[model samples]
Target: MRTREEQQSDPYPTTVEIHCLNQFLMEDWDEEWDRISEELEEQDIPVPEGYYEIQKQILDLHQDMSVVEILESEEDDDGEMWYTIIDVEEQKIHPGMPRYALMFADKPYSTDIFLDNVFRHDMRVPDSLFPQTWKNRQAAKYQNM
Candidate 1:
């Protein structure tokens, strides 16, 4: 888990750990991705870089994913990388399963901690309550370079 101070400083961070993931979640991850990739290539579909990471961050922000426990990708037998997002306050991923199961690995990608639009335009963020901002918002908007 990361502290708020940490997130505020760099909301978009990169990681490749398979933290706290279930075996069932990533049953045949590598094969699935390989198949998908081949299919996309055959169709001449442009493969988006940082594909998995971008999707995970979007899901997190949209569902307000709380905290994650990582198991690191290289440690598993199938190299089965996985992680579980848990609500630190409640200590559960909604008292059962998480909002979604996601696959990650291969290419490095930037992931958001929470607030979307805080980083990559390539990322996704659903509609949600926004924090009141002063001129800092304008300052940030202009500071982007």
Candidate 2:
């Protein structure tokens, strides 16, 4: 194992642990699809027929996939740290998967951190929040972008 001094000297000190949101968050796939479709509509993008079915099949496989690479890390306007990650293993296996995710940094594996905050972007869709419940959560909950 690297010594503390060595670890501290490293430019990139991120220790990426493999974790799945599926284990922590009970996602409503219907609400997720609805949010995605609405986001698409707002952007004037066409929602392809059968897109929801395709997304369902992809998310079903996400339970075991956790090979993520942090592509970018930034703090939003509210000062919450968020990381834009790419699911490397899933991308290698299937390009159709929503491989890009924007995840909260403070609570990377917490269900509360992901409450209506999980956003996924893929080749077919833009950065869209899934399973959104803005009505229930506070306005701050919707400011992760």
Highest lDDT: give the candidate number.
2
Report lDDT (CA) for all predictions: 0.44, 0.46
Per-residue error (Å), model 1, residue 71: 7.3
Please, what are the lDDT tens digits per residue for candidate 1 over residues 54-77?
A: 865665455322234321212246
Any idea what lDDT model 1 has? 0.44
RMSD of 1: 16.4
Q: How accurate is candidate 2 locally (lDDT)?
A: 0.46
Q: Write the per-residue lDDT of candidate 2 for residues 64-115, one digit (tens) a residue.
A: 4354444445565776555444455564221112322222233255445455
The C-alpha TM-scores of every prediction are 0.28, 0.27
Candidate 2 residue-pair clash tally: 0
